[model samples]
Target: MKFDLDDQQRDFASSIDAALGAADLPAAVRAWADGDTGPGRKVWSTLADLGVTALNVAEEHDGIGASPVDLVVALERLGYWCVPGPVTESVAVSPILLSSDERSAALAAGELVATVSASAQPRAVNADFAGLILVSDGQEVREGSAGEAHDSVDPSRKLFDVTATGDGWAADVALASEFGALAVAAQLVGAGQALLDASVEYAKQRTQFGRVIGSYQAIKHKLADVHIALELARPLVYGAALSLADRTPDTARDVSAAKVAAADAGLLAARSALQTHGAIGFTQEHDLGLLLLRVQALRSAWGTPTAHRRRLLEAL
Candidate 1:
């Protein structure tokens, strides 16, 4: 009934955290925001060296073979810096490795990047920086040049539009669809974690009326509410990941709930963070604004809170 990380899982997660913290997120995000090639291209090599790129891939396929808990931990670190890439695709594909006959082989290597199209949309977007694009309803799984990426709310991780060609054997359409949902849920949890951290830190540092703003009842209530949400959402997210990893039947409902809770938590935390910072948080110079933007974008992506809420209610 309890969910926790083992010593190995904690160490791996900590390693990724230390690496991300050392990577200098502010500078990287600033460069990325300025349209500097997705996540400051310079950090990729270092990230790869850190084994972050291989965290979720199968061990037999040359990956570190980290478990779902490990992957979740590493993803949290990635979100802490808002560093971008196909962590979603990578996580979703973890189980499909030996089950597929397509070019998915290169996908497991961690030498390449991959992302699924947001949905069954015909726009045919390739994952930016990803050598393999797992198009969900993609018309082209065939290999081709993944077109240049435009601005994304999370620009540190770029996005691409590519035609799905090649007559590759699509893996279990149903399972992959489910994984997509779970994968996005995982990503949102990371953002939610970051938002929680940002809000807590801001509440302590920002002062108003010659006193720490967090000391006031109103601010105390808001931050406390956010902390409550953090606790509520954390276990659900962990449960969703575990369910997906175990292929449990309740995964669909659990994943959807996790995704919705995470999206709401992230949005609430960001808003709370901005409010705690007051007007200064609105300024472009403050990192709080960036967090706001990320929360906004992430909430809408994968599936909106309303969409998942409806699904959850329907399940009940």
Candidate 2:
């Protein structure tokens, strides 16, 4: 079996990259943080028009029924651009939890955004912006409403308490958690790559001691290490995606391993990027701050690295 993405998948990734590259992503992220969803929603609309929202839903729900690998491809680009909202929920988890065809169809059509909370992860992300809210307790899922909003390190990510009210239906919360972890792993890989790229570009132009910092051995080694970590983590992310798509026996184990690798790589990249840019990287006005904060937030979003590492060890 091939261990790489085919030409078609590469083309799809490129299309998403180009589309998001054109949008004012930094501005959109800022707007979302300030409780102004108009700009971010416009960016979401652009992604919907590209068929991103339909990638994971079933064909019966007017979706493309694309593979999990395809969903990862789209999400990676979203993370690279730092797109705001409940991305993993709307694209990865909701399709599995939602029993109503009408709700699924609305999701496929991008007419609805959804957020979910589970027994393990009780807070729903961006609940105020979601059209649908779900609360799950391992075996059952129920419709829910958003409660109080809580601030996140990444302002673009708003967590909310949710209260389950309606009758519930049977669903596999374990499978949904696996999918969520897989999606977050893919995004972490993308965000790491973005960080590496920014650091390299800054090193090339910023001069120190009358010489470009990129020429220094120390900077070179640091950036090289970041590159190596991201490269190592990326394949694991895709491999886990493939395992999930094929329903392999070791799917959960693979997903946990991938999550650990991605989280480590993403954190390393964030630290290196901040160090490379010095004090400017910490300022809110700097664009790098957006990616830095996002990487920190996502590192623990689905499950913490320590938790995933323990899960991997147990699965072994």
Candidate 3:
């Protein structure tokens, strides 16, 4: 399968990114971090109108029948914008759509928003906005705060301790969990690249010893290392997405590898970026900290490097 985006896809992604940048997420980020309903809700509506909401849905469900690559492109664009909402959860609804017609309707129509718990598969992965939820054991159909959730590391993104949505949706618990792991891993690949760029820029401008810090060997090596790590991890992420898209039998193993690699790269990239900026990167006033927070949260929520390794090794 083709790896790089075709011209059409590239243009589509660029359009989304440009539109999102114009809207600005600062106010929403602040509100969400404080545990309030964020401006992302409106952004989500806007995205829906732009066709992001239905890009991967089947035509019968009012979707565009886009490829998984298309979905990845969309998500990367979202990360670039730092846009937040239940969108990821909404996107994660793919496997469920394969299982239940009702769930498919909710996702495609955008009449519902959902989040999932990393804690369980077929469980409440959806953050309770799901008009219906699927746990491994069974399904529950309901609405609103099905469980407790706290403000996430990325204030704009919400997390939940969701227990049930109260639908009859059934998921292959193992498969669902594996898919979640991979999706988050792919997200980190995009995010880590952004963080690395942030650090490199900081290193060049911030001065030390009568020169730009980026000129120093220490900073240079670190940036180089991040670049290497991201390059290695990035293709693995694309491979996993491609494997999933291809409906390959090795999807789980490929996904696990991608997740572990990308998550580590992301954490290191964030830390290095912070260091390059010296003390200021640690402050909430700067943007690097936001990426750092996202790295920590996504790495743990889906599966740590250690956790993914264990799962992968067991397979071997």
Candidate 4:
């Protein structure tokens, strides 16, 4: 069957791109890293206004009632900009995990920011900013609190140790974890694309040996390889989204496979990007460093490459 994204989906994704393009996200990211969440929160509000916060919430709860496919489409764009905080948790997993809870309404409206942490997640990302942290493990979910901050490779991600508090309620932890993994996979694809885009732009501008480096065979080859990998990974991510949306028997396998492919593609793009940009890519001042660090963090988020590969093998 054809796997191309329809015109409407492409247009929707472009709208997110346009919105974030105007958000000055790199500046927002720097502000977030320095403990100034004002700019970041403003961007979050912009996303909320775009109905991103309501993508996965059920219609009964005044949500857009979107499918995982639509969720991933928006998620990929969020990743491209390297938007901070628990985007996957807030936009994708939380709605499904906290559907019955009253807080879900506030979350859908962007009036509150919530996050999730489980045995799989281990640490709550952006916990310092989250108004609610839900801890779960497939059978039950409970509100939790942040105890201590843990530094992440990506400075924008503020991970924290979490402990459950208050009463517990039932939830489908398995599905939430699967959806979380799928969201991260989509993010990886976006991060990988960011790396590729940055590298290509730098190559076109940075001259070496009296000519643009992008004209060199080696540079061209590296960029071409990353492009190919990202192109291949995109379908798997979207396919898994479709599988989850349809509640198919192979949903687990599809999600796991997508995670593995995305992580690998993202990491490959990272390495290639660093090579293309040379020493400059490693420096903090360069914007490429932001996407590079994000790729490293996302490679291991939700699930590691090895873990997903193992999960895919088990399914096989």
When summed lDDT is taken over every stretch of 10 residues in candidate 4, the lowest stretch is 96-105
Per-model CA lDDT versus the true structure: 0.63, 0.90, 0.68, 0.90
Kindly list the per-residue Cα lDDT of model 3 for residues 64-95, writing each as its tens digit: 76766677777766765556555555665453
Put down candidate 2 lDDT per residue, 75-147, tens digits, no spaces.
Answer: 8888898999999988899988885546899898899999999864689999999999989887899999988
Q: Write candidate 4's Cα lDDT for 1-316 as tens digits.
A: 8977779889989999999999999999989999999999999999999889988888888788988888999999999999988998888888878957777788889998889897668899999998889999658898898989989999989899999989888888889888899999999999999999899999999999899999999999989999999999999999999999998999999999999999989999999999998998988788888898888988888888888888899989
Per-prediction tally of clashes:
12, 0, 17, 1
Displacement of residue 40 (Cα, Å) in model 2 is 0.7
Name the Cα RMSD for model 3: 3.1
Give the least accurate 10-residue stretch of model 3, judged by summed lDDT. Answer: 135-144
How do the predictions measure up, each by TM-score?
0.85, 0.98, 0.86, 0.98
For model 2, the local distance difference test gives: 0.90
Model 2 reaches what TM-score against the true structure?
A: 0.98
- For candidate 2, give the lDDT of residue 106: 89
In model 3, how many backbone clashes occur?
17
The deviation in Å at residue 97 for candidate 2 is 0.5
**Of 2 and 3, which scores higher on lDDT?**
2
Question: How would you order the candidates by lDDT, starting with the best?
Answer: 2, 4, 3, 1
Worst 10 residues of 2 by lDDT: 94-103
Question: Pairing residues by index, what is the TM-score of model 4?
Answer: 0.98
